[model samples]
Target: SEPFLPFTAQKLVELFGLEAPDWTQAGNGQLLKESSSIGQMGLLFEKIEDEVVEKQLNKLQESKKMNEAANAPAVPMKEIITYDDFAKLDMRVVTVLEAEKMPKSKKLIKLKVDTGLGHRTVLSGVAEHFEPEFLVGKQVTMLINLAPRKMMGIDSEGMILMAEDKDGKLKLLTPHEGTASGSTIS
Candidate 1:
């Protein structure tokens, strides 16, 4: 409830049978007669409450920062994508008809693959682990519908997927026993 004891002159006029005195006209008179001394305690308490709210906001922000750091291995900050978008990738099993070391390039191998549909020439950078002669005639998995990338005057139709070995070398991904070329890899 409000402070009821300290009533203004207008309020006192309605409470007590007295005409309100206009301070400007009554020069010698004071309307409030006396004012309530609520004191500085209320003002000081308000400032303390404001500081507590600020500390709570800071604590919440710190907790958010700690949670983000704890989940760093999960890559939580990466952009979200839909499953339909991932399904758009066209991957197929293709037989490596020929493989050869690229001229002047250390890790690049020019491989000609037979995708049951047609022949596609792709320049894969996986020569470090696979010897061209050994890789030939092997059925390897390739991304068939990838955007064509041109390198050394060759238009690479698709990307040949590879895995990273313990030595940090790229190992060509191949299909298991007897999966013929042009097989749909789901």
Candidate 2:
């Protein structure tokens, strides 16, 4: 009778047409000499299986780390600034007179806002999250003192203040009560 071997060893021996080892002389180590080929093949398969398992575990651990990082805060708090620096910012309430998507731009919207001081042309990157029609007539906060900058060949007079939610959606910052356009935000 042949020595009992693992299923994998038996399959390997049958697949490769190898002779079965005698089990009667296992105490005398005759089985070891006769079954060396099957034992080696079994060991190779076990090593390959172990390596595959290790690679899968590594992939799962990497995915878990990425998920944790994604769940962390999107932005950290900035350094504290002096009251004078804060006062330097001329933040005002502005009413959107007109809004339209910028030409050849996917994220920019051109806005004509009434700052109470005068009408100002402002470019904001909110087209992806908001429609031009939705912004029209909406009252929102703005920083009016920023030096005018050219975007897409047009001058942008001010920056609109917006807040981002946990889901990464952007929302306009508006006064709780109706306020006159150009009114300073303290």
Query: For each predicted model, how many residue pairs clash, with residues at least 3 apart or on different chains?
Result: 0, 0
Q: State the lDDT of candidate 1 residue by residue for 65-119, as single tens digits.
A: 7776665463235687788877988888999999999999998999999999999
Error of 1 at 143 (Å): 0.2
Which tens-of-lDDT digit does each residue in 1-186 have in candidate 2? Answer: 133557765676565554674455355634335444433333424445888899999999998877876787868889999999999999999999999999899999999999999999999999999999999999999999999999989999989999986567899999998889999989
The residue pairs that clash in candidate 1, if any, are: none
Candidate 2: the clashing residue pairs are none
Q: Give Cα-based local distance difference scores for all models.
A: 0.77, 0.86
Query: Measured by TM-score, how close is model 1 to the native structure?
Result: 0.56
Clashes of 1: 0
- By lDDT, who's the top model here? 2
